[model samples]
Target: MPNSTTDTYLIGDMKNGKPFNGFFIYPRTNIWLIFDFYLNGKRLFQVYNDLLTASMVEDTETSFTAISNKNIFVNDRLKSGIEVTPVRVKKGIVDIARNVNNFRTTGFILTLFDNRSPEYIEIRPIAHGYELISTDKNTIEVTYHASGKKLVFRDLEGRVLTKSKRFNSDHYSITLEKLAYTLKYRLVDAESLERFVKEQW
Candidate 1:
């Protein structure tokens, strides 16, 4: 069972407890978990992977962003099947893209958490040429540029959840992950993520 190479496993008439495999990307780390009936059991697998991924990384962009924002979210899917939820959305500033002094890294972070929970998400740009797009619960998309920026949160039905405030300089950007928190929150910002990339000549 340890060295097995089967892509799929079946349980309870292919319906009950078959092993499931998935990956969770956090702001600080990227972790993978595999559930199998045999090797070390399911509980051990979850515990091991969670602990492994929770290890701190040097360049933690997501954790920094989350802290800057002051809110967090967990995957809605994990709420049903998995028992553990590692900081799905950090409450801080996510660097969407940067073109500062010729260096560029373009990406976005998806946040999650309840809006009425007395906490909000934040996005801050460490470098100058960064942009943030906030897609609130209402599914309305608003783009935030460096200067002459406004903050707005809308519901999916085109109703304004909240109005946008002008922002010239803020520390972070934020959003609430409704159902897709699991799909989006898996992007972690770490120093070692660069190592996984192949070098070019």
Candidate 2:
């Protein structure tokens, strides 16, 4: 479903497969939209409502507060899950909020993958972010540097997944479907996703 307000902006072209996620604060819908694209032509998505709150918005202010000094313990509920599983982070974290000046949009994270094979994800820390490679060869390189004013992403296609910069409403935002079409990849809308979301939720 398309968002109603023009207030909606895209935070996409992240990666097409497992463990790779692209996210942004989509306020107009007040719903969590999760998407995943896979190499074997599989796709997964989920949606949730009413997760946003004043506290979460306030926390976005600190989402990118120099993680180099602290080993932050992230207790996030994520999508349809009701539990907060704590994941400790020592490295390989890049908070987009650090680019308050460069990126005006705000959003939370979303994961798109069926809990199946390609069992694990490998993360190698780079300059500002990390390089993520899945067992199935799905690769994504993320770099966000506010100080140097550099923000780049390479997901799936070895080269930059995005070839054009259409919207800077948040410093580089594009829809996943649009990006797929631009890349000449098939646009998939799984009908069973609605039932899948319910099953997972």
Candidate 3:
């Protein structure tokens, strides 16, 4: 399999007999399918929360064959299809995370696709020594503070998932039906903050 570098694949026709064409990330246990498109010369990616059940159809040294049983949502309706023989199979997020060299010391944002809804979650990192804000809106903000070196996962309406005084990466592995995430971070020199933003944002 290839690395996390963006690759192209074919999304077959829908089960309802509708023709479809798109690109997606390689199938993995947990991954995002970002459809790329151009509008007025501006590139954009449409992220979808999709589940795949893949079975090998053929195998070759250069490329392999597989069919994916895809479950996705379109137009507020659940759609399913069996994609036969995708063009290529590349690596995904989970694969990149397994390779430690990809780790960034500075904080970063993780964009997640919610399986149950069209809404997605944006996990943002707050700088140290800042006052956390509170809002009663539907959008939630999960904050990590340096005071007690604790990480607080909560919704804007005030629902807590895991709050630990001690920083632990495993705390985020727990599945919360409304909001689920896997947090990973590394401590870096405070001076590198600017560079981090440029690289991530």
Candidate 4:
């Protein structure tokens, strides 16, 4: 692939001689904005969020800061964005394009500079409707929203662990045993979710 220079998130600058900008999408937040800038194959300037600015000398650094600006868009809605200062950064190098089974297991944990506790966290296998389960013998609690809402805090074997109150929202979560493997069970938003699953399966 030659790479794309023409996108909605990029801004052309003939004056500054910057040809293209790279954009990244935050899957959980549904936020899409400029992720990096390439000026003739050299990454001169890069921004993680809308607030902070960074420079790439040799392209080793993976983390960047997010700044509040009018250019940033979240969920296809415009807003006065806030700054995202990374509290922790992880570095990984792999060819995801070639190996279609690559799924990002861990993600960046970010805490705002002004806030003490972490505000934003990223996780994998996100979709409109999904269920997290422990692949081991441990029981996983869940509230399945089929035709009627049912709350069963139990494992797949129907061992009742706890009871949950009635909820009406499609967005929900249940914890999986940390030591055991987990599986997401659901097929919501088939067009986007199915394609991702097929590639990563």
Candidate 5:
């Protein structure tokens, strides 16, 4: 019920060496992307809006089609995409999440760059319809950019956390076709990144 996990966000090098990551940013209503999850036992529905709404199901390999009615957005802003990690609790139930929540979302986005060397950032739009171009290979160009900050983290015998180099509020953007990277990147849903980071702890 969503666009994709961080798994399929690669292009041009699926069968070769370690594939390159293309951080394709989904089209934003304002400045955010929303992902909705619905879990029915082993099957979980991940839905997102990319101009028009799109979705996918995860946790099973059964070849089938998933169809369900969902309200993608409540207002005109992006909703928080938090994944419930407790096995006893359903990950996608909003009401249950409210009652059983414990994780603090203060530095959530900072945790997304855990081990993935996130490289390029691509902002694309739908022209006529969805082009379904790999991830960052845009059929119709909307806007493509990325900005890397000096990041720091300790991966020792203990725990490792995503740390930002900047402590203050600062936003920067870099636009390019291909940029030289000491580290590459990944294109993913904001919520998937959130869930992935949350599970690690």
Candidate 6:
């Protein structure tokens, strides 16, 4: 098995010659897993909140499915103009293309790959509803809306990084230095409150 790591990639419309820097996490093979994508150093998808995952299927042509968790927070705020595309990377001697299509509510497909099975695949989400508020060497802030409520996320110190709105949701996230923290609304509203900690990037 290949050890999981974030691999840097240069991806975009090859014809344009303006490929942006991106990265994806490939922790394992044969199973769809979360892929983190970025463009010009800005994370394009909230893979941690969206729970994005994908896997390649064996067939005459390359095929795969990328899915996001079906949760109210995501469903309520999903951008109507979502766009997806397969990214081809140059790995040594072979040039592999991970063709993707059939985009739907919570997932998409990697239709094929240049007539060969790809050892790995990378997918990119063109637009997500959230907007970047600010960033510094130590912290980053982002904002989005859900259930008619505004959400503001900041790095450590629990500061109101953005002036967009007041903290409305019981759910929120924060990252400071090396520590990641989140308050899941679903878990908080559940019958039993369970303490769960998850790593985010």
> Evaluated with lDDT, which candidate comes out highest?
4
Per-candidate Cα RMSD to the true structure, in Å, reads 16.5, 20.6, 16.0, 15.1, 20.6, 19.3
Report the CA-based lDDT of candidate 2 relative to the real structure: 0.29
TM-score of every candidate relative to the true structure? 0.23, 0.22, 0.23, 0.25, 0.18, 0.19
Model 4 agreement with the true structure over 154-183: per-residue lDDT tens digits: 444556656432252222222222211232
Writing each residue's lDDT as its tens digit, candidate 6 over 24-100 gives 45332223333444466544542321211233223222233334432112333434322333233232112112222
**lDDT (Cα atoms) of all candidates against the true structure:** 0.27, 0.29, 0.29, 0.30, 0.25, 0.29
Model 3, range 1-201, lDDT digits (tens) per residue?
Answer: 132322343443233443233443434323434343222232233333222211122234322223222333344332332111111122212211110112332222222223332222223345542112222122334334454344455544456655422243222222222231223233322223323323332
* Per-residue error (Å), model 4, residue 24: 11
Worst 10 residues of 5 by lDDT: 92-101
Tell me which of candidates 4 and 6 scores higher on lDDT.
4
lDDT of 2 by residue, 1-201 (tens): 344421232343334443333333233221122222221222223232212221134446444231211111123212332111122123221111110112221112212233331122333445555444433334454455445323244444555654444343222223222222222111111222222223332
lDDT of 1 by residue, 38-119 (tens): 2222211211132212223343644333321101112222211122222422332222111112122233232222333212
Candidate 1 regions exceeding 4 Å error are 1-4, 7-85, 88-142, 160-201
Whole-model lDDT, model 5: 0.25
Which stretches in model 2 have alpha-carbon errors above 4 Å?
1-115, 147-157, 163-201
Q: Give the TM-score of candidate 1.
A: 0.23
Which residue pairs does candidate 2 place in steric collision? 16-37, 24-107, 25-106, 25-107
lDDT tens string, model 5, 1-201?
235643443322222332234222232222124233322211132233322112122424321222232222224222333322221112221100110113223111111111322212322223221111112212112222454322222222223334312232122112111121122233333444334324432
**Predicted candidate 4: what Cα RMSD to the true structure?**
15.1
Residue 31, model 1, lDDT:
27
